[model samples]
Target: MNKWKIILDYFLKFLTALILIFLTLIIIFKFTIFNKNYIKNNLKENNYYEKVYDSIKENMENYIISSGFSENILDNIYTNKDVEIAINNYIDIIFSNKKDKIDLSKIENKINSNIDEYIKDQEIKILDKDSITSLVDDLLKIYTNEIELYNMFDNYINLFSKLQTILNIALICLLIITIILIIVLIKLKIQNLGIIPFTSSLMLLYIRFLIYNNIDYKNILIITDNFSNCLVQIVTKIVDLILICGIILGVMGLIAIILDSRKKNKKKE
Candidate 1:
């Protein structure tokens, strides 16, 4: 009977550790990758949108400078930074989201307005307004039609929504299992509470390792520096959470072990 009881206690401790690890993973996913709206909001809050616009403007300027668009016209456009302002205004409109459907005409009008002011203020000479208009239209069309970029976001949102039901069910089951395991361990007079925090710290260490190993910083930078910055910021938030949880768990586990040791010492005395 004593041997069987010892085996049962060890089994319960093993199960408790697994449950703790699983619960930590679910919570991390719930707060990080699965939270679509939060990521979007964080991007906007961090001025990532503006940085993207700046990158686009720099790329466009480089193109206009190299495309043989006539020296004087290029001089006026680049020297006055007319395109930069126009692109910035257009990006602002895109981020505003004041309307349900984003109309190209709205962006066109905003850019046109900025361009008119730019021309008047800089006193620039350019014969073909239509040519400039056509160029801007083409760029806008290309930018908006980049479904791959937009689809990245759409895919994340869709994935989170799809997983919501499954996550809900799993979360409930895991939570119940955790509670039952805790109660059973206590009843068996085993120190399973320390396993909770110890498992949490181990899980956080694994998560940190994955984050460091999986993210290819060079590839992310090649895509866009602004995007890379945003990715780092988000990942940093996750890392911070991991560190906080690890510290708390490590402290709790240490305290539990110390107290358990003291109880044993008292029994010996």
Candidate 2:
């Protein structure tokens, strides 16, 4: 090959490898991170009962300890099973349905109604609207925070929507360019097709190593237990898919090398 052709060949090979890795990543993130249906289905499958239940229980206990309610009243209120039941129902509703907007007013009203029933059952005479408001406000703090987080995620998804068209176009163009590069390599009598899958596998292995070594799940859990659990679930699914793809590509690369070797031997014979 002439100097210019040789340089062009090397550059195309490098570009092909880079595009292979990028294409794999784009596909993975597109399906897992940006796909709303996938996220919703995964959370539904996990149920999130333990994470949501424990966080709610702990935060409410802390709130009750710091509040101005009398010890006897607080003790009676905390001991009631309805608090746990209400929290579970709240979480269930939020996760089980795909709603555009979360109306805290509706949630507050339902909680107030539940509190009224609880007071009627306990025959507590001293608990007026002010006291009830204090208790409900304290309890709703966690729910409100959760709603805010949901809104943040909703905004994130919206941003993804704006970028989706651009991403799709780039993905398609990259795929076509990658295929053309591979075909050109073949026409130039360069056995470089295996490099695409080999580079893909290497990229996935690097990502897997980073995930295993760099993440601090403990700190995440400490900061926000429920959100951390959800994050872990999503990361786990992504890692699993990466591992599967890596293994498949690695195997294909090996098979291609073996076949290439066999073909060369047959020509010599």
Candidate 3:
């Protein structure tokens, strides 16, 4: 065997060990060592979640006005054409921006504002102040409904985000193991033309990634945002999964090297 080959074999083993260490450390940080809240919180800080809060508030205000006119007004708040657009916008603001913590108080205030305008159309009848006061009291029910809706959305985002994180972690581990195994098998069977097809496929896969994506192999980023963005999010986690596997394969390449060395020695003996 070439002296250089021996050196390379040792290097490969060390490299695999290093990768495993990193994986272990990060896993540790994720579950035990690091601040568990930081991931979602960091997501929130990425952009001003306050903006989403404001938008929800605005939607609630619109809901109030439409509701006060008649219970039929709920149609405008949820089923009306504009309501769909507003809901979509709000989703983008929270999910697109990765912020699930929504503020319903802002929304309640918005509903009340819209209701205030509709109330203006009612002429003040001083003949019965009690009746006027009663109307105002009844209108507050709309605020309650708007707040409930906002809370529902908040719960949805929270659950969705947690699922996203768990999926990412699982994919990462799979990719790393896949890559290491592939690389090790590749080195061991270097002379087997039969395995060339697999290598070709791998090369093509790598080329596809390099050409289309520009993400770091290590220290990947998982960004979340409020629900206004149209871009799909699974891309980030999937790409990370692929890269993790690739790295593991690269690190585990030494198994093939060792096997090949033993074969050459046997032939000589």
lDDT of each: 0.61, 0.64, 0.45
Cα lDDT tens digits, model 1, 153-269, are 433444445576678789999999888878877787875357567766777777777877886543455345566676777767777777777777778877887787888888899
Choose the strongest candidate by lDDT. Answer: 2
List candidate 2 stretches off by more than 4 Å.
57-100, 115-138, 147-166, 186-189, 215-219
Error of 3 at 135 (Å): 11
**Candidate 1 residue-pair clash tally:** 0
lDDT, residue 70, candidate 3: 41
* All-Cα superposition RMSD per candidate: 6.5, 5.6, 12.5
- List, residue by residue over 1-269, the lDDT tens digit for candidate 2: 78998788677767786787778877987798656567656655665544455555566667767654333332333322433344444444444343444344645676666656656777777636787787787666765554344344443544555566667787899889887877788888775466667767877788777887897543455345556677788877787788887888778877777787888898899
Question: lDDT order of candidates, best first?
Answer: 2, 1, 3
Best-to-worst ranking by TM-score: 2, 1, 3
Per-residue lDDT for 19-86 in model 3, tens only?
A: 54445334533442133344334434433344444444454456446433543322233222233334
